[model samples]
Target: MSQYFHSVTLNKEKCKGCTNCIKRCPTEAIRVRNGKAKIIKERCIDCGECIRVCPYHAKKAVTDPFENIYNYKYKVALPAPTLYGQFKNVWDINLILTGLKHIGFDDVFEVARAAEIVTLATKRIINSKKLQKPIISSACPAVVRLITVRFPNLVKNVIPIQSPMEVAARMVKRNISKKMGYKTEDIGVFFITPCAAKVTSSQIPIGLDTSLVDGVISMKEVYLKLVPILDKIDHVENLSCAGMIGISWANSGGESTALENEQNIAVDGIHNVIKVLEELEDEKLSDINFVEALACTGGCVGGPLTVENNFVAKNKITRMAKLISNTAVNDISNTLETVDVSWTNPITYKPILNLDNDMIKAMKKMESLEKIYNDLPGLDCGSCGAPSCRALAEDIVRGFANETDCIFKLREKVRGLAREMMELEGEMPPPFRKNEE
Candidate 1:
């Protein structure tokens, strides 16, 4: 495997070297070089912001092919609540689950049901009053990665629970294999994802060593297959086993609401999430007990890989939750003993900012970076390809960029060279001088 696995990638042929993506990237992971945008794998969190902002359609996400589900003898689908929002006028979540069986899947497990299990675990942790204050939610893979790369000090503040996707996969694998007398290898659990981050998270896990999910299929890809088959189905199965609290997870503030904690705060959008983390670093939010951050605006419904408009999707999810509120929710109080929801490994800070391993060498490089930054124009015009003037300076100190890459700095050197050329004309030898007209 490669050193770093990223689902969000660049299409060089379609790229126009536009600075649109660099300015919007929360991690400053993109840079235009040789007239095309490039992703710095170490800095990328796979948040899908670049995929949303690129106008030329140059950025795209990598997902498993739809046919991969047939590879297993018994194929199961773990459909995220975000998948329900992609369809129009679907009053029942069970209707959507039945549609999956028509195309290829033999069985369906609602991720929302798994979400309720995670909710119960989180409330238990909050009651214990252990660890640091203001526990961070680990539901969004992009937000967890953002903390590791940018807010290193807040790594400990993150909750150590596995996401609902992982929980759902484990549940499906265990139940199907044991009851059917099939080997674990023969069962394939696939997650229907709505974002690029989930695609990478399933392959290269955040807090776990290996993900139980066998594959990840995009919601957009599945929506295409379900559109024609939905109206044709004769009967809908009673497969959905989640309540309103679990289904609410499709939109922002859903997780916080389930906690029933007044001391918590919820924030969405990648940039807005950064602002909240910065405040937490400054010790401004010590009074708050929990911080719920999601990379995409409007929660999973706003993911770039989804087909519906964000506003419309959010409304659909709200309506669907209410439509099924009368149905009883599955009680997951006994699931903790059956499946492990807590992470086996701790989340660690990814050291991308270090200039060198040696302290003295790193300090010296910091000094050089500051000196170069002071010399350049402070306007972060993106003309030099880096996100900001300081980013260009850091690139120069790292030997990836030259000082003259800045347009203003290059202009200064050109003017100085022109003046010297005129001065040298006066001292040239008679033979070397141009003949007077």
Candidate 2:
């Protein structure tokens, strides 16, 4: 069985067998083999790092078709706050929300609205001081998956909370069902997402049994459709209710700022997040109260599925927050009562480091792996398809690669064979020997 339902995929036809993806993957999940890059599904967190680095456009994140929204009798669009940063001149979020309705959506629900509600709930959780110190934010599904697979020891450090997308979807379904007499199943809640991770999260949720989100559509697709009709729309709805704090979640430190905690640290970009998690796992940051980690560089704006430049998008988000002059719109403490915002199950560790299922065999494999690693050049040149020498050594121990797969090793083997042949020539039978005479 596939360990994770991955939204990120490889286009073998477009791959150039370059080391770009394999070199950059934080999890070392990618390898160039047979002139094509391969993704180890269990190790891939769908962070879209490979998608970001591929020059040949071989790595792509697969989202639901835009037409998939039409499956239900009623369709509701859940627009992420990052969607606000895509447009250049449009400052009002209401125009963006209304534009979705004009483009066949029955209604629109702002995911940022749910973000505001989650912010309030998070503050309460922090004040309660119930969770482990430096509680990691679970907003980024990619980061959560990375923790589960790579940083398994820090699994308990993640706060158990439903994501804003799920909260928004649940809110939309509940409100529509109650007001319009539409059945929950008849209403389609589609998230206009900024990242590939959200697509996988919507399809197969982390902490919940099933996600309330019916479908996930990319922001780039929605942006193309919105551009044509945005200039024509004469009226805008009063649908932009999410305030400054929630709106700021589009940027790197937005969530940490929302908590209003001076002791908190917010780090973005997958690599940086990994470093921070490493420190946290080592108990170095005992003084900190919260850790807000976003997988994308400039947070959701830097996501592979989004169209805008990350810095430009980040600036627009800050400007938009001030333009609207919106405070936390409403006290969402009561909203938490109406909706289930916490996790349905505990987020458990799913370690991918073990060499085997059997303890003794795994120990032997580790020993062999270490020996192989010691023989490697340690250049991490990625010439052997794997991301690093250690990774190649691991592959060798696992029977996926040969020592001679490495150029240096191959050269050494060639030299050894030449010496052996020279030695054998002196001892060969006279009839089989090649003699200058």
Candidate 3:
């Protein structure tokens, strides 16, 4: 309900005030203070890196409970493609789709179907418009938010397309409402999410004013619920709508593969994505056609909320993709053309990292920040409760901390005090010597 809706949150009681999260955070949104981790609302992209790194399980993603589905007259389960990869030895996609219905859903929808549509739409956009080189994929909400926060200059390069999850939610809601003669609000569309970023996206959409999805459920929770009913279904419905190409979006390089662009590159892991984005920002990859940047290491399958190991999940997804018929891609692509899946809303830049609202003052602050940074030890040790020495310098300039907060600086101060005490002791008169004389 805050200005920014974040799925990731901290449990203050469980936090040990460790610097693990502060250092790993891609956007540097986390800071440790008062023996707890605090998320900066404006800076947080909800990438779930903190949740992944927290040793005490203090960081958690807020997801809708399974029982929340009963609040609506109808419920639709929108499962991410990564959901299919979570199960072991389950090559039959239909079994997983049917499993959701058995687990208490009125209907099931595959976000992968929408991914296929996005692929087609993206290809058309790439071929039609003289788009900026290395067009960034908008599929990863975390990556999109990262650009909005840190790389405003690269916002224009983001492909103007809704994510597969959003598209699928819209498509499912519209189709179900029309077919069943039910109002949009009467039906609840739940996205079975693999990561916190998708949960945040469902609640506070980036480009749009409102999200089509009604709720989000974590994959880890859904996996637990669905496993008991996975193999018990008497009738496996033929509800597999997405092809292998679409389903392949679960793993790294899958989107680029679907786009079929020779010059496209797919990079995963938030840190690696940052490096690639920096290179792209420098115009080093001007000849590249597209950049598919996923925040997790192995794409959605490697989401912090997932149960399966990312590498194992990727292998499972690859095997399943290969077993499916090749013609299914064309079939799904054709069906997607009939749906209104294009993104109409505009994305605005968020200057969260801006030093000040005033241009002149901001410049002055920047100069002062650099001067402070140069004075501090360049070691990126997080002893100051900041990610790095540079971050500590920035915090000092922003009035959040002082240079003495640095352990090395504090050590020097302590040494100076000790030296002064020693000198004073040496200069002091011998006990009662002057009085006796």
Candidate 4:
């Protein structure tokens, strides 16, 4: 069964045949062809790394417009824990929340509160032996998707818990619907997202059959509209329900701090996260009590949204985390005991890559691919739409690419003509030699 959602999209007309995305992609899901870029649907993790690295800003993430909120009578903004770090030098969290109302939202809910709950729940997950060794963090949808596509062997290591984004969506709907006397259908919870992966998560939830979050709006798009009215929104001293541990969710060290187990470790950036997970797969992480992984380096501060520099924003967040009183995540765990904080959605165990499936068909495809690859000049030129020459060969075998996919094949024709000209000159001298014989 093919599962696709309107998440990350390509703006073909704007593409400049740049290899920026090909190199930056963690999953190597994109290929450059005919001076344009295309995404392999099954392989894309929707990390939005392409969107961030594109010089032309050609890569785009599909999202429901802000006007879609009118579909429901009561709309709420469930901003991700990462969203809070977007604001710099502004200590007041309510300034951002209140601004959501002025920008057409009816109410706001902090996803960090959900993180506190998730931290507690994940602790139980770690303690339980229902999963394979070194359970991977299910927080980043892109990372989860990466595991499914490129590293199917690691899927067993993925934690079964739904992401905090989904958890927060469920909490928001439950709280608002009961308190405000509104039905679940009447309340729309939109996430203020920093990356496209979160948008993908909302559309095709990793662990859940359906998503609780209604829609997603990019922090980049929202910030463009919010920056102009920063001073106008009425500010309260402490509108944030989250303590320091919750706010720390925006950084790499966030999970370790929130868990406060002393043996926990937090890792950020896709490359680093993958490395640590690999080490864990080998049981090297048995000594460590916990692992927090983030796809983007420096955590949400390095997300594709916000105008502030990531390093600058990270410094600001570090200071902010220190100022707030440290609250134990266990307190939250104690409160949600038997409160049904477990994932309300159904979880599926199917592998996305089918790596362990029958190898006969794959072997045949690989054999044919090797022949085609040998026939063509081995240039990793983006002209074939694959990231490299080797990738084109793989795509051809996978049935997603064709023989004419290479522009270098046409270049070889010109080289053939030059060789023919050299042979013609030798033929003229050969005629004279035949007459002498």
Candidate 5:
């Protein structure tokens, strides 16, 4: 039921079994075992905090290869707005697009273009909704997934619109197919993404099942292949695919400004977003009209796949914003009309919690699991293969692990077992061997 496995993986041999990742994980997703760290896939949010903190650099995200472009008759590379920051002095965005051509892509599509549509959709929703203030952006998959798992109460605040990457893939396929006289099936749209979350988003879109994207290549992989070719591409066109509103999607508060809302607030970084979300839950932030919360600081520029310094990339994006036209998101909606913008309905919109389609069964499970959780060590050491002590208890109730399997509790039980065994032995027999030896 997971969209795709986008979490960081360990090179078991390289892992030093350190507790650094365990302490840093928001979800307590890593556990040290047999002198190596193991990932709890179901609990991992794919935020890549483990990859960032790992001393040996044993953690790596799996990405699609560039050769995947050949899977279709025609291929289009949809680069995330963050990909632009990977280069130095790359004033022209088309240089990177053309560079994709040199690297084997037949065509290039900007995810920023799709961002334009999302910007409009979100603005429309914000303006039209009769509900509460502080509409949350659903563009960042990690932030979205975090809400689904940890903060289900805020789900209604999440604007239910397709992410910019999805929109770009759909648009490019439709427009290019129409322009080139080819069928939609003949075109392959690959998103050049910034993190594992986007890869997961492409594989399993939240509100939809089949994604518009055909494949995904991370920024880390793309940068390795494109660095040498960046300067060599001399015949690049001036793409101008996205305006300021679209380009701003790469940074913090980008969506808020794009929507032209005066009362909105934007916060970046996972901890910061969590604090704001907590405030939202308490109804303390009810006055704000919109809340743009990104799990990564500096927005997509700080995503795990990006190679450039976050501060440096943020500056570059800021500088780039000044050169482009400052078109509002409302203006960009006109462009989407010509493109085939239909979406597969309700695929990504299901509730992830099994909580109580049947309330009686769910309540009984919760009560039994609550008692088990109370007995746990609360260390969240991940030794039992669940992410945390509470998660381990849930797993026990779910029938994946037994309550006694927790190493801390097991050691305690073993001590009690030893005492019981000694008591059962009664009086001990005298030794036959000589004590002088």
Candidate 6:
């Protein structure tokens, strides 16, 4: 099994263990125990939902510090399309790209430009191949992980194309190396990420064995440094290479729109995506040609690490996208033709939710789990730190929790013990008999 490296982590000091994260976690990957939130290593998808919903700011995404850029001889900033949506009242994308250079990057590459290439590549694939119905986009790492853990059957439906970030990283590194006579190793490509999923993806890629981007810097962290410099730079020497089609990818429905497919559906927010994926798995949406599922609401702009409000940022991106034209590069076919966009390795299902590795043992455990679940109150009250009664039963079978953790069960047990104590007291010899003698 591959070792999991999660971006989302708990800060023990800040966690109130109020069951907020456990309730919100789609995969039931979290449990509140001993007054702290614990993430199950096998089940965590790094969706950053816990980080977003945590009231006490206990959940955090681990990202590379800005100073880590100095580790490379040559640094390139691969800004996500969502980064353009961060700055309020800024329409020109070049200003944001240039601002990255001011922050100490040797060169700036737009992940959006690579998004344009991906758009073209995806279109080509859709046209050429008779793929499974409602082919899911492989762009969202969190969604991919979700499918792996929860809906393993739909893994085949996921498009095998590399993400825009990876494509851009490869292109930028190769181009920079050729131009500046620098080795590819010397040129470090850092992705300016909008969520913890991207951080985890960069560290341990899903489809690919290694990520082209060297490090991931959270958008919230970069926003602080970029905003002050956005105004200071008078003239942006390097204009944005990506057009509206690519830049619109920051918001929901952008990818579907770019695909120009009438039968495509775009779903945002992890829960909504899960619902749609469930429908797809049930073969309910076979008519649809494609499914653009973004883990974050309103797409990348709404990511947990982003500084701006998702709705507001989406509006800004929409407004900016209107002004920009699709004039970047008319033909990405040549690049797509040469590049290896397909997955190098196969993506297998992760049976994290399964009771056991052994079929017989798993079946036995399932029977026990069902029995335990039936015995519970089935309120899904989350009082026991698990999301639902079923989840608590699973935890109990897994030895992470017991029936006593359930408040109702504990209450009933306490009442039974009290009754037994009363019955034993009634049967006991009178204490005053010795004093009378």
Scored by Cα lDDT, where does model 5 land? 0.78
The models' CA-based lDDT, in order, is 0.91, 0.91, 0.88, 0.75, 0.78, 0.89
Deviation in Å, model 3, residue 55 alpha carbon = 1.5
> Model 1, range 1-437, lDDT digits (tens) per residue?
56589999998999999899998999889999999999999999999999999999999999999999989998999998999988886777888999999989999999998998898899989889886888999999999999998998899999999999999999989999889987888998899999999999998887899999999999999999999999999999989888887888989888988899899999999999999999998899999999889999999999988999988999999888887762242358778778999999998988898887888988999999999999989999999999999999999988999999999999999999999998986777777778745
Once fitted onto the true fold, the runs of candidate 2 whose alpha carbons sit more than 4 angstroms away are 1-3, 327-330, 422-428, 431-437
Q: What digit string (tens of lDDT, one per residue) describes model 6 on residues 317-400?
A: 999889987854546667777666677876889888878899899998899999999999989999898999999999999888
Query: Which has the higher lDDT value, candidate number 1 or candidate number 5?
Result: 1
lDDT per residue for candidate 4 within 240-260, as digits (tens), equals 677777777887788767656
Regions of candidate 6 where Cα sits further than 4 Å from its true position: 429-437
Residue 141, candidate 3: how far off, in angstroms?
A: 0.2
Can you tell me which runs of candidate 5 are displaced by over 4 Å? 1-10, 29-41, 130-132, 327-331, 339-426, 429-437
Per-candidate TM-score against the hidden true structure = 0.96, 0.96, 0.94, 0.86, 0.84, 0.96
Write one digit per residue (lDDT tens) for candidate 5, span 1-437: 55347646788888887767777777665666667877766566777777777888888777777788898999888898888877887877778888888888888878887888877766667678754567888788888877877776787777777888888887887788779988898898998878877777766676666787988888888888998988887688766578777787888877888777678898888878889999998899778888888878788898888999888998888888778876564556676566534334432323434544577988988998899999998887766756688877776776767877799888999999999999977645567434534
RMSD of 1: 2.0
Q: After superposition, how far is residue 289 of candidate 4 from its true place, in Å?
A: 4.3
Find the 10 residues in a row with the least total lDDT in model 4.
Answer: 347-356
By summed lDDT, the worst window of 10 consecutive residues in model 3 runs over: 428-437
Clashing pairs in 1: none
lDDT of 4 at 399: 74
